[model samples]
Target: MSGESAKGQKSYTNALLRLENITKAFGNTKVLNGVSLTVGAGEFLTLLGSSGCGKTTTLRIIAGLERPDSGRVFLEERDITYSEPNKRDVNTVFQNYALFPHMNVESNVGYSLRIRSVNKVEIKQRVADALRLTRMDEYAKRMPTELSGGQMQRVAIARAIINRPKLLLLDEPLGALDLQLRRRMQIELKRLQRELGIAFIYITHDQEEALNMSDRIAVIRGGLLEQTGGAAEIYDAPRTSYVARFVGSANILRGVSALSSLLPNEIIAVRGENIVMEPYSEQSRGLKGVVTDKRFAGGMLRISARLNQSGAEVVSSRHGIDSPLTPGQSVSVSWDAASEIVVKDNDTGEVS
Candidate 1:
């Protein structure tokens, strides 16, 4: 699902937006520290992380809603670090939708044009085009109060895109919808982006959302970019323990427990999907373990094991196929050596 290879072929000069060493702080607390990133033209790049991790703050900085303490922002090679929001060629879609309750869909979609003193005839045509692009043309006469959450979202998008901005910043715009609705919107949003051929800087804490919709995802932590790559690259080869655990469920084996002389002092990160629970055999390539816990987790059977070599606990999961695994059972845990991700200890500056 990663578009990294496709995006890698392009040159940096073609980036639609660039953030250089962006830093921001609220009083004594630093919210963003030297964050830098780039979004290619028509690419869907997601800023993915937990709350207060600076994803939203970064998006606001790019939108000109919040200025950074230091750093520069470029749009189409033009430095707009201090440009007014209105003058920038960008639009933002927030989580709240922020539509005018008193206005109908057409009026709301054409609000920007109206504020610019555009002719009524031209505004009407643009509004119609925007509404049609979002497939909400039939609901043009409906008020915000009467429209469903999805419909309201469509209307908001129509309004944001009516200006045909160079870049669109979506700040958790789908966070308010139900799970099913949110999933549907994810697909619709991606399709719309491809059709519009405009770059999107989407912000979300949901890993699934980021993987599902992003061409590339930037994982932020402590006001800095922790890792950035396609979903597969980030998942299969996380640069740090934090990213491996945060991006998905992982079983980390450290020190002597990892049983890897190549990185004897480092922590080995193995994803749950990569670990397999099987009967003991001389040909088995991983650590010997004893099953300590087992549970049915939706579609997979999650098994927890304590490694015999170092007594460290590790988790593995298998698809439901009537496995005989049970608590107190002796089982071997094995995985491909290529799947073990080496992560360093940031505090100690050690490989572990």
Candidate 2:
């Protein structure tokens, strides 16, 4: 279990875990449907989806918390499909810090080692090392109630990694924190993963979270893998309408005559930021639309307009906070041909 395998497949020759055609069901509802995934050594891969979309179930299978009805789980060329959780070289950090309320930080972090009958001297050294890695060494004696959300999370991580597991699974580990704190923890987690050189399998339903931390993201929908790629690839060239619509704010144009040369019934998607909005003029080029609504976001002004020809709502974004647009005002919306992507169609819709 501690050795590497040369049989690792695909673009990664050093994958730490592989699940082939994993299937699971509860009663009659199939939670996971032949889902296959691979985590490269020291790579940050996120399983992203909404609730009951099989993301959590997938993570549980990898951690041996839940057994897949069918499929093979491999770790370093060895089949661990039916292996007990304790026998696997993996650890899981759940959203609920799950820290023992009665235990101090140091005790909580060293509990695993103590349970295994590790020598007290070695336990102390490993606990200190894990705490230092997570930057929680200074708070080693603090009680769980005395620590903030982020601090408690660090302690939880320290406990999980104290054994130096080959792979770490995180199930929405930041779901409980506020937005600002969550963002900060996201950075901290990514940095820790890089510093430890341990493969991280993170799970989250938040698109921004996955995009922010993952080296690659696997988007799951309705118990199926929707798309898997880097943040930019998944955003810029989504293979399906669901991915385009779910991953970001997209304006799906279906048979919008104002947009030229569109195939019949073809559904094209354009990111809000990609659409250029300008004041309407007699000679203004591009598709014509009437501004229906405008709102101010963090760094951009989001505008919603109704296409004159197709009556379809198209959203566009303007940088900064200056907006002269009012409801019922006319405007021109256009984007570069290269920026437009075909996501889906009613019949024979193509993706490129």
Candidate 3:
């Protein structure tokens, strides 16, 4: 949800990390062009997009793993564009976990302290504390080979948090896990992050994961950032056609906004779940539609229909009802007038 009131409050912008006019190129092809974004302190931010969209590159720039051709980076109001990875007060947990197979969990967790010449007593205490935070203390003596997938992730997180970095960068850290494990880890990760109070910059192509875990998400496409906002704001109030279609399943239809008073003049919108399929003559103020098809989708029944009055296609689903809805049923689909979002031409799918 947006951290502001409706009636269009001013957008919040107290950035913790700022990227100004960042540009990157591989030979002649530009990977990132004047890309800019800011991450708020203690907020879980997810940089989301398909491959080749520069989200990974942007994460790399923050980690000091990749240098940008142009622009400056500021972390906590301090310029750190040219700072080495070792000097930056941050830790990166990559998709691969990047843990050393040769090292035990405790050594891997305490490596940074050990390299800094921290006394053995201090390193032991810190590593033990970090392991306890991830609930991996029992696995401290085990090698990376002996740990389960979830246990390995915990170890990796333990390693990253051991040093108490000011920021944490997660690039598809949960991509490899099975569905059950990923779901479990996501909950654990979110809890741990909230407890630690360190800002997180996460990267992922999974929109659901981004929405589920992040305070806000940045959607990028073709090396350009399309939009950034909280999960509800972005999902319920998409700013672009790509965002609408990508974030969820949507039926895009073209119509004259001026002609249809009921249909949302806005771009693509999946039919809201709250819309009642049954018709009422007195209070029928929604889009005039006809039921075209309905199908059982696991626990819920999905209904696809077309607007008879406006000729627009609509896709909706009904859940929790054991009775089945018939096909080609007559229904006047309706939506709240105030809930209809107005998107720009570029943001809305083109008429063509």
Model 1: per-residue lDDT, tens digit, 233-258?
Answer: 88777887777777766776754444
Worst 10 residues of 2 by lDDT: 1-10
**Tens-digit lDDT track of model 2 for 223-251:** 88888998889888887777787777677
- Against the reference, the lDDT scores of all candidates come to 0.84, 0.83, 0.76
Compare the candidates by TM-score and give the number of the best one. 2
Clashes of each: 1, 0, 2
**How far is each candidate from the true structure, as Cα RMSD in Å?**
4.3, 4.0, 5.7
Model 2's alpha-carbon lDDT is 0.83
Candidate 1 vs candidate 3, TM-score winner:
1
What TM-scores do the predictions have? 0.88, 0.90, 0.81
Better of 2 and 3 by TM-score: 2
Model 1, runs deviating above 4 Å? 1-13, 262-265, 279-293, 296-298, 306-311, 328-330, 346-352
> Residue 8: error of model 1 in Å?
12
Query: In model 1, what are the clashing residue pairs, if there are any?
Result: 345-352
Model 3 segments more than 4 A misplaced: 1-14, 248-250, 256-270, 274-298, 305-313, 319-323, 326-336, 345-352
- Clashing pairs for predicted structure model 2, backbone only: none
